[model samples]
Target: MRGEFAHLGDLPEKQVCHECIGEKYLSGQIEVEGIPATCDYCAEIETPCLSIVEIAGRVQTAIEQHYSMTPDGPDDYQSAWLRDKESDYNWEREGEPVQGVVAELLCAADCIAADILELLSDRFDCRRPGDPDEGETEFAHTSFYELKAHSHRDWDRKWQRLEVALKNEVRFFNQEVLDVLKSVFNNLHQMQFRTLDVAVVQVGPSTALEALYRAREFQSSLDLKKALESPVGELGPPPGKYARAGRMNASGISVFYGSEQAHSALSEIRPVVGSNVVVAKFSIIRPLHLLDLRALKTISFKGSLFDPSYAEEKQRIGFLSTLTDRLTVPVMPGEQEREYLTTQAVADYLAGMSEPELDGILFPSVQDGKGVNVVLFHKAALVEPLAKTGRKVVSASIEDIDYEFDVRHPEYEINTETIEELGGSVPMLPLFFDFDAHLESLRQPEHREPSLRLELESIEVHDIKAVVLQTTVLPVRVTPQRQHRAGHTESGEPKF
Candidate 1:
C-alpha cells in the first residue's frame, strides 16, 4: 500500500490518533481498533491511533465516492472548431488538489496533519499551483471540487410523465398515477407537519377568516328585493342539476366557491355591464382543514448532503414550489374543459384524502391576484339555516276581515323610565305562523347540517354599469402579401 503511493511524497510514519480527526465517520473507524500510540498530529501522550498513510487512503476513498471534479473549460464555446483551435488542453482534465479536498473531508481543523494532505495531493492527479506546462494558475483547488449531482432522473421522468398523462392521456382511474400522487402527497403532508408553523393553515369559527364572500350575477331586470330575500339554496352553491363545471368541479357536481374578499367574489362572477351582482358573506361554522397552495411558493426543504434521501426530498420540494403555477395558469375561453381536467382531478384527490381529512383548498384567485379563492368539497359545502331562534310559533293571522292591508311603523321610548312605567313585562303577541316547522319543511333531506351560515346583513346588491379590464398589450406587426389567381395560361401551361 505504501509503495503504490510512493511517487506522491515521503509517507508520514507519525501515528495520528482518532481524536486528531475532525470527521465523525472517519474518526469512529480509527477509534474502534486502532493501536494505542503517540499521536503526532495532536501531540497527545497516548491514544487509539493509525498511521497517517492509512488515514490518507481512507480520505481518498470518501472523496472519490461523494464528489466530482468540475470541468474547467469555458462554458460558452462557440463551436467545435473554436474548441479544437484552443492550444491549452487543461479543460480535458478535471478536479482540484487532493490536499484541499482532504482538508474539507476532515472539516478543515488544525488537528489534521498537513503532511498527510500534501502526500495525498501528490498521489492524486489534481489541478495544483505548479504544473509542467503552466507555471501557475489563478484557479484555487477548492473552487473545482463539487459534490456530485444527485441521481434523480427517475423522478424527473415521472414528473414529466404525469404532466403528459394529465394533458393528453388517461386522467381518471389510472392506478399508476394515483400511486404516484399518494406517495408525493404523503411525503408533502409529512413535511408540512414537521413545519407546522408555516405549512397547512386551519380556518374555522375561531380563525381570522370567520366568513367568506360569494357573489351571483343576474339580469338588471330582476327584482332586487326578491333577490335579497332568496333562501340559502339559491344564494349558496347551486344544486347538482344546476351546477356548472368550474375550475375545481366538473359539471353536475356541487361545490361552494367563495373568496376571502368581496372583490374577489365579484371578480370571479365576471358580471357583464348593465347587470346586477348580489354578494353575500357566509360564516364558517365548522373547523375547516385547508391546504394553502400559496404557502407552497415559499416553503423550503433542508437536509444533509450525506443523507441518501436528500436528493429525493429536495426534488419533491422543488415540484411543490412550482405546483401553484401548474394548477393556476390561465386557460383560454374555449380550452377550459380540457385545461380544467387536471385541476379537477387534483381537487377530487385532495377531497378524498382521509388521513388529515382536508375540507377545502385555499388558493390565489386567477381573476384577482390579490384575492384568495376557497373551494369547499361537497362534504363541506352545506350552508346553515338562517334562523337560529328557539321560539316556536304555532299559527299566524290578521285581526280584521277586510281585504285591504295596511303597513305602519310604531315608536316607543326604550329607556329604563319607560320600561319601569310599563312594569318591565310585556305580554307575548299571538303567534301568526309555525316559523320553525316552515323552515324545516323547506330543508332538503339530501343536505346535512350546514358548515357555513349566510350573513343576511352583509348582503349587497351592485348594479354593474361597466367592467374595468386590466390587460397586457403586445405590439403586432402586420405584413401584406399580394395574392395571385391560380389559372392555366393560354397554352395550358401552369400559371404564375
Candidate 2:
C-alpha cells in the first residue's frame, strides 16, 4: 500500500453535491480503491467540542481523586464500558499499565451502575481487536461485550449494563459514545423494542443555522448576566441547544447542531452568524439539551396557522421584546417529501405565472405577511401521480408522530397521534401557551388588550372531527393543455 500512495497532487479535486455543502460528515472526495465516487457522509456529526472536552477533562480529574484515596469506581454511565476493558487488560500496554489503570478506574467509578445491571455472561473471549471486526454482524460488537452477561436478569438488565459499558469504554467516550448512549437510553426509556414506523425522523444542517439565527435575533446586546436572570420563560440560557423538528429538511436541523461544534466547520459557510443565540419553536423536533425549558430563553406554539389563532398568541408567556426576524428559507422541497400546493395552481392558471412564480405563491390569507402564516396545501393544488406507489397509513399513528407535525404540518392540521398509543413513551411535543392566542385578540385592529384568561390547551383543541365537504361548482369546466402534467389522472389525489 505504501508503494501505491497518492498525495493531493494525484487526485482531481472531486466536488461534493451542492446539497451536501456545510455538513459535519462533509462532502469532498478522495480516491478510494483508485476510483472517485459520490456517496453519503462518512463521519459522525459535531456538537459543542469545548463542552465535550470540558466534560472529559472533568472525568479524568474525578478519576484521579478517586484513585488517590481508594479504588472507587466510575459513574455507572462510565463504568459499564471501561470496566470490562480494565478486567480484560488488567496489565500493562506499551511497557506501561496506564491503559489498564484507566480501565480499572472506570470499573471502580461505575461500581454502583454495574450492581444495577448485575449481568454476567458465560462467553468471554480474549482476542486482539482484529479478531472482533464489526463487519460480521450488526450486533456483533454489542453481542461480543454482552455475552459476558449470562447471569443477567432480563432485557432491562442487559440494556442497563450496555449503557454503563458504553459510558465506561474510553473509546466510546468520544462523540460517537455520546450519540450511541443517547440513542440507547432513548430507546430503553421510550419504545423499549418498538421501531419508529411512522416518521423518518432526522436532524438536518438547516436546523442548526435557523437555531443560531434565532439566538442572534433574541440577543441583540443582552449580557449573560442579564440573559440567565431567569431559568426559563422570558429570560434564560436559551433553547438553541436543542433540535428543531419543523417541516424543514433533516439537514437543516443537523446543521444547527454542527454549527455549534466550531466556527470553522466545512458544512457551515456562514461565520459568526450568531452567538449565544436561543431558539424556541413548535416542537423539540430534533435534539437539544433536555434538562429544562425554564432554564432557556424559549417559546413554543400550541397549534398551526390554520388554527385561526397563531398570530394572536405571539406575546403571551413568551419573550417578545427579544424577538427578531424569521430566518431566510430555501424554496426547494425536502428529501422524501411529497405534498401539493393548495392555491398555487389557481394563481398559475389565472396569472399564467412561470414554475418559479407558482412555487413561490403564498396563500390568500397570508400573502400580506400580516399574521402568522404557514404553508398549507389544498389537495387540488398539487399534481398527483396517476399510479399509486403504496398505502401510507397517516391516521394509524397520529399522536405518536406529532414532533414531525410541529415541524412540518400546517399548525391547525391535527397530526393524528395519541399518547395512549405510545404506551409509555414521553411525547416530545411543544407546549402551546394559551394566553398568547388571546393576547393578540386584544389588538383586533383596536388595541383592546383582550382578556388573557383561558388555558393554552383550550385555545385550539381540534378533537378529531370527521367531515366531508360538498360543493356544486365542480372542476369539469376546465380543460388541460399538454405539458409535464399530462400524466396526472383526472381523479383526485389523497395526500398526507
Candidate 3:
C-alpha cells in the first residue's frame, strides 16, 4: 500500500489523527482503521490515526464518487457558457484554498495540507492562485471538483411532459400521466412520513384548533338571510351538481375552500362594491391529516453524499420546494378550466390515496399573500349540522321555528316560541329537534362523515365599500423608430 502511493514520496510517516479531521463521518472512519501513532498535523502523541497517504487516498475516492471535473473554457459555438468580459469561463467550483479543503476534511495546517494536495494533484484540478505580487501563494486557490447533485433539468422535463399530457394529449384515462404523478406523490408521501412534523399537520378542536373562513357573495339581503339560516348547508361545500371547477377540483367535484383569514376568504370571492358578502367560520371537528404545502417550500432531506439515491432525492426536494407555487399559481379568468387540470388531478390522486391518507391540502393563499388557504376533499368537507342533541328523538318533533336576524350585530337568533304542541298540552321539546340525527337518518349510504362544525356565532356580513388591490406595475416603454419600407434597409437601399 505504501508503494502504491509513491507520489507521497519523502513525506513524514506520522499519521493524520482522527482528532485533526473536521468532518465527523470521515473522522469516524479514520478512528476505526487507525493504529496508535504520533499525529503529523496536531502533534498528538499516541493518537488514533491514519497516514497522510491513506487519508488522501480515501478523500480522492470519495471526491471521485461525489464530484465531476468542470470544463476549463467555453466551447467554440457555446459563447453563453463564458462569463462576461472573461477569457475563461467562470465555472462553478469549490471556491476554497487547498488548505481550506483540507481544513474542511482534515486539519488546517500548511505542511500536511500541502502534502495531501501534492499527492492528489494528478487526480484533481484547481484554480491558479493569486499573483505573488499581490502577496499570495503560487499554489492553486480553488478545487475544480463540481458536486454531483441533480439539476432541475430532469424534474422540469417530467413536469412539462405531465402538463402537456394533461392539457393537450390525454386529459382523461391517461396511464402515463397517472404513473408519473404516482411516482412524484409517492416519493412525497414517503418524505412526509420521514418528516412527520413539517409535512403533515393535525387540525382539530383539540390539536391546532384551526378556524377556517369561507365567504359567499350574495345579490340580495334575502339570499344572505337564507344562507344565514342554514350556514352548514349554504356556506359549506356546495352539492356535487352545483359544484364548479376550481384550482384544486374539477367541475361537479365538490370541495371545501376556506382561508385562515376572513379578509382572504372575502377577497377570494371577489365581491364588488355595495355587494353583500357572507363570511362564516368553521371549526375542525375530528383530527384531520392535512398536507401542508407551505411547509414543503422549506422541507429538506438529510442523507449521505455517497448514497446512490442521494442526488435523486435532492432533485425531488428541489422540485417539491417549487411545487406549492406551481399548484397555486393564479389562472386568468376563462383559462381556469384548462389551467386547473394539473392541480385538480393532484388533489384527486391525493384524496384517493389510502396509505398515509391525506384529508386535505393547506396552501398559501394567492389572493392574500400573508394568509393560507385550505381545500378539503369531498370526503372530509362535510360540515356538521349546527343543531344537535345527545338524546335519541322518541315521539316529540318540532313543527316550526322562527328565525330572526340581527342586522346591527350580524347574528342569527333562532326563536323556539313558534314550536307547535305535540298533544295540545305537551309542547314539542327543543331536544327532539336534533338536526344531526335527522340529517343522519336522511343521509344516503354513500355520504361521508362530517369533519367540520360551523360556529353559528362566528357568522359575519360585510358590505363591500372598497377593495384594495395588491399589484406589481411593470413600465411599458414606447421607443420611436424610423419605419423601414418593406424589403428595404433603414438607409433605403435596394431590398436584399
lDDT of 1 at 398: 16
Put down candidate 1 lDDT per residue, 265-286, tens digits, no spaces: 9999889887778788999988
- The sequence of per-residue lDDT tens digits that candidate 3 reaches over residues 72-112 is 44465556656457566554434345455554545346666
lDDT of each residue in 191-227, candidate 2, tens digit only: 1111221111122123421221112222233342232
> Candidate 1 or 2, higher TM-score?
1
Per-candidate TM-scores read: 0.65, 0.14, 0.68
Alpha-carbon runs more than 4 Å astray in model 1: 1-123, 126-143, 146-160, 192-197, 220-227, 389-449, 478-496
Worst 10 residues of 1 by lDDT: 409-418
Q: If ranked by lDDT, best first, what sequence of candidates would result?
A: 3, 1, 2
Q: How many clashing residue pairs are found in candidate 3?
A: 0
Q: Which stretches of candidate 2 lie over 4 Å from their true place?
A: 1-219, 223-226, 234-496
Model with the higher TM-score, candidate 1 or 3: 3
